[model samples]
Target: MSESLTIVGIAGSLRAQSYNRQLLAAAGELLPNDVRFILADISNVPLYNEDLESALPEAVVTLKQTVESADGVIFATPEYNGSIPGVLKNVIDWLTRPRGQSSLNGKPAGIIGGTTGMFGAVNAQMHLRHILPLLNMYVIPQPLVLISQIQNKLDAAGHLTDETSQKFLQQHLDRLVSVARRMKNEQ
Candidate 1:
């Protein structure tokens, strides 16, 4: 049997009740036995600084190591002003540092997010999709997991209550694992 795939999940929002974080929790619960979903804490990742590249912050170093060792990455972002939030962008910047030596190079990534708005963070997801390739990350192209009107769909415990949404999320995660394995084989 093939070894299990490790997928690191990062939620862009730092809010205690962020819909994005709730969506990540649901995804974690939905992961299959062959796939593991690890939630990464980006709340303490400091702002990017060129000076720190020589001696990266402990948080940055840990973030890079975690992602570099993972088989795939999942970004759960909340849109702010039609784009990704500053905190999430900061994390990305730190990971993309040292240019061609980024940890995301050739790694598979999936985007999932939740928002109160009707569009469900589509704009932010698109922006992220555009950025991941620049860092040499392979992004899953199908089954976009965008949760809209999340307030009505999630339970008090922050779990996805809609059956259809749960099914789709599971499908997307399965696809992510498959793609990640394929990429690993190619490398």
Candidate 2:
């Protein structure tokens, strides 16, 4: 039997009740048996500092290692003031360190999110579309997920209970796995 593909997920929100994190949980439940989703811990990642770039903190090292080990990455972010959240951007900056030796190089990635607003995390995903390519990531093009009205989609335990949302998430996960598998085989 083939080994399960590992996808590292990063939740951009730091809030305990963040809809994006809940969306990630939902995404996790929908993944296929051949795909394993591992959520990256963002709580301990410090603000990006060029001086510390040479000697990354232990948390940052672990984060990089997690991404490096994964077959792909999924970024679930919350749009903040018409842009990506500060913490999310900071994490990306840290991941893109040493000028030209980014950990995301040649990795496949998918972006999705949930938000209270009507547009969900559209702006944030757009920003990532532009930014990720610069870091040498092969991002998926079609079927971007921006889950709006998040409060109505998740249960009290932060699990996605809405059937329609689950279908949507499944579609995205399917695409992520497909693209990630192709990338993995190419290497």
Candidate 3:
């Protein structure tokens, strides 16, 4: 049998009770046995700075290494002022630095979002879809997940409790795994 596919998952929210983080946790539980989803900790990643890029802070180095080692990436984000949160953008800046040789180059990426608002995180996901291509990432085209009313989908413990939401999340994971597998072979 072929080796299991590894995906590095990043939650774009730092709040202790963030719905985006809860969505990521649900995704981790729903991934298939052939796919491994590991959540990358973004809590320690410092704000991006050109001077720090020379030495590359430990957290930044770790984030890059985690992304580079994974077959694909899954971003669970929240919209902030109609775009990605500042912390998430900071991490992306660090990952895309040095111009041409970004760690995310040519890698397949799946983006999903959870928000309390009725629009979910549609704007943020749309913006990321445009930005990722510039970073050389092959963003998946299908099974886009924008979880609205997220507070009702998961429990206080961060587990997915809604049947409909679980099914939707599973579908997203399936698509991500399939696309990542195909991209892996293409590379």
Candidate 4:
């Protein structure tokens, strides 16, 4: 087995009880021993501004450094009107600053999300699938974790109680680990 991989997980919602946040918490429980999952704080990251690029906010700088140092990233997004939330996109914009020299460039990423809607956050994830590549991120292709009706799937402690969700999350993490390792090797 290869060495442990450090993954930074970003939850897109700022709600106190966001399903996406709970989903990421559950993912941490399912991760393998050889993986370390760290949740990035996007709540404090201000809106992206080109004028502030040269003097980025402390939060943005910390977020960028964390992502740049990680072996992989996991985006837990919340859909709004069949699209990704603006805050999530804003964070990505910050990471993509300095144009072709984005911190996310060439990084491996896994997209997952939860919602009460029947289709889950598929629309949001699809948007990210297209967008991450533009920032030069290599996203995992299989085992997409579009957790639908998430309110019933998680417990009071934010643990994913559904068996199917657990299985899919495990599969997604497995692929992320393999892909991250492969990308690191090629780097």
User: What would the TM-scores of all predictions be?
Assistant: 0.95, 0.95, 0.94, 0.96
lDDT of 1 by residue, 22-113 (tens): 89988988887887778998877888999998899999999999998899999998889999999998998998887776888888899988
lDDT of 3 by residue, 150-173 (tens): 888778788978777677778878
Clashing pairs in 3: none
Q: Native-vs-model 2 lDDT?
A: 0.87
**How does model 1 score by TM-score?**
0.95
Kindly report which residue stretches of model 3 are placed more than 4 angstroms away from their true locations once superposed: none
Model 3, poorest ten-residue lDDT window? 160-169
Judging by lDDT, tell me the better candidate of 2 and 4.
4
Q: Which candidate is the best by lDDT?
A: 4
Off by over 4 Å in 4: none
Compose the digit string of candidate 4's lDDT tens values, residues 66-138.
9999999999998999999999999999998866658898889999998998887999999999999887888
Candidate closer to the true structure by lDDT (higher is better), 2 or 3:
2
By the TM-score metric, which is better: model 3 or model 4?
A: 4
lDDT of 3: 0.85
The order of the candidates by lDDT, greatest first, is: 4, 1, 2, 3
lDDT of 2 at 33: 78
Model 2, position 108: C-alpha lDDT score: 88
By TM-score, the best candidate is: 4
Total backbone clashes of model 1? 0
Per-residue error at 136 for model 4, in Å? 1.2
